[model samples]
Target: MLHIWGRLSSINVRKVVWAAQEVGVAFERTDAGASFGVVNTPQYLQLNPNAMVPVLQDGALTLWESNTIVRYLCARYAPGRLYPEPLAERFNTERWMDWQQTALNPAGRHAFLQLIRTPVELRQPELIRQSNDETEHLLAILDAQLGQHAFVAGAQFSMADIPVACELHRWFGLPQARLPHRHIERWYQTLRERQASQGVLDLVLS
Candidate 1:
């Protein structure tokens, strides 16, 4: 049996859940992180020293890091579907997943923190603006790519689409003026139609 630990609101956790659903993994999830804090517990620490959410326990083995967990789940279970083959395709998938963690997520965090998590009086306008601009610029790059390919990595919905789409869901959920991004809008609409993305991507932003 597979066990996943994390609150559903977490984007990282959402990535694992979405992938698990996609691959038809029978798993149980325990809410942790944010208000429901199990992260610092001794047992939890044994699973993930970083005290992060979405720790995966597979029998004797425990794994953390959302993207790696996604890769592992897909590779172990749905190799030909979610986990792609071919050298070029594999690296293309890996590249976009890395880009989401390094570029898009950070750029979008400010707006999420201020608009959703932080109180109005505590929000930082300049920081929000700067991050929003960066997020738009980065997403514009994604939009350009989506204009060519149906999905992030290519025509098929691979592991690459999971993380970045989850991040994009967050960006779209924020209440603000958005730069018109037709490709992103179209891609995200298709993502919403997927059974796996039903609860994961369509949920209200945290």
Candidate 2:
């Protein structure tokens, strides 16, 4: 059986679980990392030397990095659909996935850390403000792109959407004022309505 090791509260872990659901795979998820505490164990360290929350085990294969795991699930199971078989379309999907990891996630991480994880007394306003500023600009760019297409890479939902939407779930769930991005809200609502998004998208951010 496919098994994922990480706490559900983690956005990265949520991506893998949601992808497994999207590809119609039966899998088990074990909580590890943060307060759950198994991530530092010798065995867990062997699986992911980075000591990150998300680690995927499928028979002999062990995978780290949430986006790579999502790509693997789609490529291994869903193929031309979620995996996007066409060369141009596949690269387009790959582009957005990398952007989410390198751009969007970094822009918003500090804000999420301050608002969601850190205590109010200890939260730094400047860090939150700066992170939010960068994230909103990126969100506007994403909004403009979504205005032209139904999904991030194209019209059909693909593996690309999983990581981006999970990041959105984190940013949007933050308790603060956000500028209106109508297209993002519209596309996100559509993603939330998908059956596979039930557990992943609906969870409260942590």
Candidate 3:
């Protein structure tokens, strides 16, 4: 059986869970980060030196990094379905995933931390403005891409949609201005309707 270690509240872990669901892989999850606290333990550290929330253990293989796990699982279990096959197509899909990690996540982090994690008394309004502005700009890029395709990769729901949608969910879930990005909202509504994203992507940001 495939085992994943991470707390359910984590967006990184949610990415893995959403991927597994899309690929239809049978996976077991163990809570192991934040308040759960198993990640920093000696045993967990041995499995993943980064002490990350999500660590995948499958037979003799141990893997960390949520994005890599999502890719690995989709490749192994879903292949042409979730994981695209053509060389150009695969790279194109992967680039969006990379963008989510590099561009989207970083911009959204401060806003998320300020709005949700930090108490109102301690929150920095300036930092939140900067983050929200950056995030909204990055999302406009996504909106343009989405306007061209139904999913991240053309019309199909591929591996790229998983991480990107997770990040978008974080940004959109917050109490904020109503974004005029029609394409993103449309795509997000489509994602929310899916069983794969139901529990993971639909959760309250924590």
Candidate 4:
């Protein structure tokens, strides 16, 4: 059986879990990181030297990095569908997935940290504003992209949608004012309707 290590509260872990669900994989998940505290253990270290959450172990192959884990699960279990079969299509999927990790997620992280994870008394307004500004601009770009297609990468839902949806899930949960992003909202509603997103997207932000 595939074994996953991380807490549900983690966005990274949630990505892996959601991908596994999308691919209809049977796996075991252990809670680690933050209050759970297994991430720093020597045993966990062998799986991920970065001492981060969301480590995937499949037989002798161990994987870290949430996006990579998502890609692997879909490519292995749902190829030609969630993983995409054509070379150009696969690269398109990869482009969006990479953008989520390297662009969208980072843009919104500080706001999430300040507004959700950090206590109100300790919050930094400037940092939150800066983060929000950066994130909003990116969200508009996503909205424009979604307006042209049914999903992030193409007409059907694929691995590309997972991380971007997770990023949106986190961003939308933040306590802040958001201008109505029609395309994003429409697309996100579709994602939420999927059975695979039940536990992963429905949960409240941490």
Best-performing candidate as measured by lDDT: 2
Compared with the true structure, what per-residue lDDT tens digits does model 1 show for residues 12-68?
999999999999989999999999999999999988999989899988889999999
**Candidate 2 backbone clash number:** 0
Residue ranges of candidate 4 with Cα displaced over 4 Å: none
For every model shown, the clashing-pair count is: 0, 0, 0, 0
TM-scores, all candidates, are: 0.98, 0.98, 0.97, 0.98
The worst-scoring run of ten residues by lDDT in candidate 3 lies at 170-179
* Model 2 lDDT per residue over 130-206, tens place: 99999988998999999999999989999999999999999889999999999999999999999999999999987
Score residue 105 of candidate 1 by CA lDDT.
Answer: 94
Look at candidate 3 and tell me the lDDT of residue 52.
81
**Candidate 4 residue lDDT tens string, 68-115:** 999999999999999988999999999999999999989998999999
The CA lDDT of each predicted structure is 0.93, 0.95, 0.89, 0.94
Candidate 1 backbone clash number: 0
Local error of candidate 2 at 45, Å?
1.3
Estimate, for each residue in 1-206, the C-alpha lDDT of model 3 and write its tens digit.
Answer: 88999987888999998988888878899999898998889999999999888999989999998899999998999999888889999999999999999899999899888889999999999998999889889988888999999998789989999999998888877777856899988998999999878788768878
RMSD of 3: 0.9
TM-score of 4: 0.98
Question: Candidate 3, which segments miss by more than 4 Å at Cα?
Answer: none
In model 2, which regions exceed 4 Å deviation? none
Which stretch of 10 consecutive residues in model 1 shows the poorest summed lDDT? 80-89
Tell me the RMSD of model 4 versus the true structure. Answer: 0.7
Error of 3 at 124 (Å): 0.3
